[model samples]
Target: MAEQNKHLYYIDELSDYKISDGYPDVRGWDVKDIDNRVIGKVDNLLVNKEAERVVYLDVEVDKSIIDAKYDPYGRPVQTEVREFVNKDGENHIIIPIGLVDLNEDSNYVYTDIIDHRTFSETKRYRKGGNINRAYENQVLGSYQRRRTGSADSRDLDVFKDEIRLREIIREEIRRYHHDIDKDVTYGTLETHDASRPRVDDDVLIEDEIELSQRRSNDEVYDDDNFYKRREFDDKRFKKRTPGL
Candidate 1:
């Protein structure tokens, strides 16, 4: 007697997946064997737009038991298959939509139907596909590793040189301002007081006093000449002398 296979419905058949509503929640799914042996948990859903339903699932199986041959959506690609086998040492498998049954409350799929040959064939196809293209699709290609060592040192040196030159220029500017401040203070003391004698007037008085002292110290004078006596005894001499 042939064994009776269990019937499964597509995602669109569910009442919540009608035209007015959004996608059905398939978070509750468990990968199992024909005897209902639990394999893995359903990690994601793969929706098919043409069919208006979910056609595949992303099952997280044990890495020791199976290799990852396809993307999370079950699309087969080469680089993933190569890495999965060489690094993980397991084969990738596929579970068809028809074989799975959804459990709404548990948010899981339970199924006893699985196509082993089809799953193996899909893995072979992915292995034969272009690895470079597969890697490009799964990874962000634009990001690069940070440069280090010699290249980083060169950049730091350039920055330090710029900072040193800026500091030198700032010091020269500060010294120029300081010299201007000292000259302004000296000029203010010499010119701002009207009661105090002017610098030029004080200099002239000092010169006249020295000349009178020099003439008084000289003894070569005509004692008999009244004009000579008047010249020596004039009011100008009294003004020039310190006691007068």
Candidate 2:
């Protein structure tokens, strides 16, 4: 009865189940698992077009892995084992959907009871070390496309338009300055020549000489007055002198 019950349980668990139709269509190669949670959004897939089969998926693991040791190429090194292991002593393993009994409706898988240690060992064996190389190739191809001559032409046209606009602005500024100069005026004639009375050269010279003589006379008078005051005071003081 026990063996029969075990058989029945195995049959029940192994039956085909459909993943939800709402789930995005993922190729067998694109599926990945972390404990019970599955990560199905793959960045790239390797397809066999002739056979209509997906051979492998090329995905970028979450950047959190970089918290571990990184390689010279900036890719996280897989050698750091702690990030990959779960609390149950089972390493968080990634398995191809092809290796599992997938339930399409539930988007899950079922497997026979497996020891945690054995699962970890199997995961280490199946993990692909050269996946980063494939990613590098894809990046190189994208960069090359951007560097093509056709792409450069579009950039050149944009720069040409910028230069033409600048030239138009410079021409407008020059025209503005030209108009300003046309409206302004300048003259070299003296102010009196335009509206004030003009004196003869001899009369102007005589007036200047007369003014200079008057200033000299005023200075001489001031000096004489000071000398006279000093002499008068001295004589007055002599009269007041004591007999001794």
Candidate 3:
């Protein structure tokens, strides 16, 4: 039987799932603060299996964010998770997925709601450490303080506001799609053979050179089958030339 309540999993750990079509896969994209100062790289995504969507970003912070002076202004009151100092090699942190925006042109994952100071003060964990509910709430409380300024931010039911969270995510994705589509241009492929356009001479020819007719029409049929290609047949693609 499968675990019914297993909530989160790293995107990579699931072989059957993948990022949705047309949505940006933010892994490896640079993360920036509100002012666009680079803070980290998005190392991975944490998906909620039950929700069938991404819920958090696993960011591997840059040295500046890791080394910045810690501020206690928005510290969580929870005794179990009040430590803001990152242990040696504990430079990974999680940001709620709904809080970030995408820069398709620059390929950046950024948040306008959170600042660099708040990030520095949030608790960090090992790269693949177990992230429990208490630690997640602690980090959320630290960020919530910047927006609400509530003294008891830690006790508030931030994640329970599911409607608000979904709205934020939808709005960000809509805006990002709009931005990227603004500069996109389209063109048509001029193919001589409509039935086999994939291997048409106009498409296959490259480097301002046409393929010689002597090369064989068998190439057209073989070209469509990846395993029957020259690379697999010749066995030279994986190896260096003998003399060189």
Candidate 4:
């Protein structure tokens, strides 16, 4: 990979660096989709050395994911190319760092923005192989599309609401170390905590509202600030998600 790409390295490839202190180590943690279905496990983290921060999670997908019916409304990669890419050796997928929520105690990573259907439809590459800029863009684009809204827009919105509610409840549990008074009425989540709800900066899952056109690979690869976007922000991953 070093010969293929000079900037990005797997965590194990770096001798001096380690997952920053104060974050859970999520390697091997189960990755669950919006429906609470396990899709994969964290296999490794891809770090951008220039940014000195982790950018993507390398997930070893479950068998179910491979067998899942492809999402017809998923991203439009060329049919021949996608068929070739989804071969047996390709068992891993890369997810952007900031697009997930963590359950530290439960030992899993979760995301409500991307659904199972979309995940199944995502293109996967061989583990430990070179991940080109175009592949990264495709993965990010898929997640971004789902977050902003998709063919199943109504269903996606409901799922997001439910996920938000669950996160709020979990935060309350972490705060009081016990279940706190909460009300779920009309699909709204409310808490009775006297103190203002202390939402972890990273834990608040962001909606990618701006559907800006993704930059061309040549353009992004040449830019020094390519990884400076919100999706690659180290603070977002460092604060809430796991490490190593």
Candidate 5:
């Protein structure tokens, strides 16, 4: 989730910096793809206070398929979602700060680094030891591998890749169980809309910043939604040598 730098806080929470002269708070901006197709709306930003930089734009992505001519950004170009056969569920993707494109409009953020599949498959963001350094390395490293192909990356087979992904998520669940505070945690196996905001021109918006949003239910964990812990037999999930 934006590579947990030691310094992370809402803009107003920290007094170390001020909004630079020309930039706008991009919290509720529309995130679009290269073709100017609507992908999702910006929810909040993860700021790396140490760097005085924005590290990520949390976006809620639309995954339902529609009938259109190569609308790669997942917008229903021609027909509404109901007009076409169903596709898939939605996701809240963390668009890396480096990947965003800022234009003069100041009301939108753009990115062409990926498509719907990548955004949907990537794990949702949560704070804590839930995100491991190695996993983050593998995740961020995947962008490059996704570009050039993956002969040197984990070097794992397709089956192993699935296993690795599951393990990564498993570790996160375990860590959430241990943490005193978890901004977001696994609530149910059901398709859940992670707490994200929506705003448009019609509504008068507040310029407030939210570090994280919790799912509505008070109970963050449900045994029915979780699986029995199993051993991965690999040392990487246990040891610190890295390279899973």
Candidate 6:
């Protein structure tokens, strides 16, 4: 990213995405490996404004697991035990979304290819520091290496121009926002102009139009958002169906 665009924010921080994708809100879910070993709990997600997709998942590693060495690379040789501690979110790992498996069953995300050792070995996100494209590539490449289920193989290499990547992202985001602005400016007017207002027919109007527009707005858009669905995990909200 450019010097001006080095700032990284959580997905919830972006206004347009919240209005569009309805806040993924997958934070607080557990992150695990394919075998169901607890890796971390999701702290947050990183959004690439240019790409309009989640790029990285900010995960807080479990201290007990990080403290013990585990082979994330799937090596037959057991990893030698080492001591590492989670101090001030230092143990957090920013794994790319490409490697993630969003498991709705247990509501835990999984990365089938990596483990504690990989996260501990790789260069991680430092608070208050800019993540240059080169650093980001290393992180992505690190995960990619293990994705093939191989501890030893050579199939992942792409020479990327960080500066060029920055320019491309900026250009993409600019065009995306331009189209959005154009639509916002004319969408209502276009709809109104298409249909003529008929005075003879009485308008039986309700606030359903505004409510329907909010279908993808926020937590309210959720089918049983304010109320709980039958499969709800908590008791704070009412059931979607009326109680007996």
TM-score winner = 4
Task: Sort by TM-score, best first.
Answer: 4, 3, 6, 5, 1, 2
Give per-residue CA lDDT, model 4, range 1-244, as digits (tens).
Answer: 3453555678988899898886667899999987889999999988887788788889999999888746433344665544334677788998877667687768899876677877887878889877777677667656655644532554455456646855765454345422332331222555545564433323323211111223425344645677875566545444453364
Please list the residue runs of candidate 5 whose C-alpha ends up more than 4 Å from where it truly belongs after superposition.
1-7, 63-91, 126-139, 145-244
Better of 1 and 5 by lDDT: 5
Cα misplacement distance, residue 201 of candidate 4 (Å)? 44
lDDT of 1 by residue, 1-244 (tens): 1112111223333555532232345444566544455656655443333344444444555442344333332233555464323233223233434445554455555553332222322332122122122222121111011121322453345445546845664455445544644332323454444554433334435554444334323132212331221112222111123352
List lDDT for all candidates, in order. 0.36, 0.31, 0.61, 0.67, 0.42, 0.50
Task: Quote the RMSD, in angstroms, for model 4.
Answer: 16.7
List, residue by residue over 5-24, the lDDT tens digit for candidate 3: 23458889999999875467
lDDT of 5 by residue, 1-244 (tens): 3433233444554567665544466767877754567777776655554446555565665443122222223223466553222233324445556555655335677655544444434444432222233333333433332322422333334335655855665455446443633432344333334563222212211111110111211233222221111111112111122352
TM-score of 4: 0.64
Clashing pairs in 3: none
Positional deviation of residue 111's Cα in model 4 after best superposition, in angstroms: 1.0
How does candidate 1 fare on TM-score? 0.29
Task: Show the lowest summed lDDT stretch of 10 residues, model 5.
Answer: 207-216
Which regions of candidate 2 are displaced past 4 Å? 1-24, 27-34, 37-40, 70-97, 100-103, 106-244
lDDT of 6 at 222: 28
Of models 4 and 6, which has the larger TM-score?
Answer: 4
TM-score, cand. 2: 0.22
Count of clashes, each model: 4, 5, 0, 0, 0, 0
Per-prediction CA RMSD (Å): 46.8, 47.3, 24.1, 16.7, 18.7, 20.5
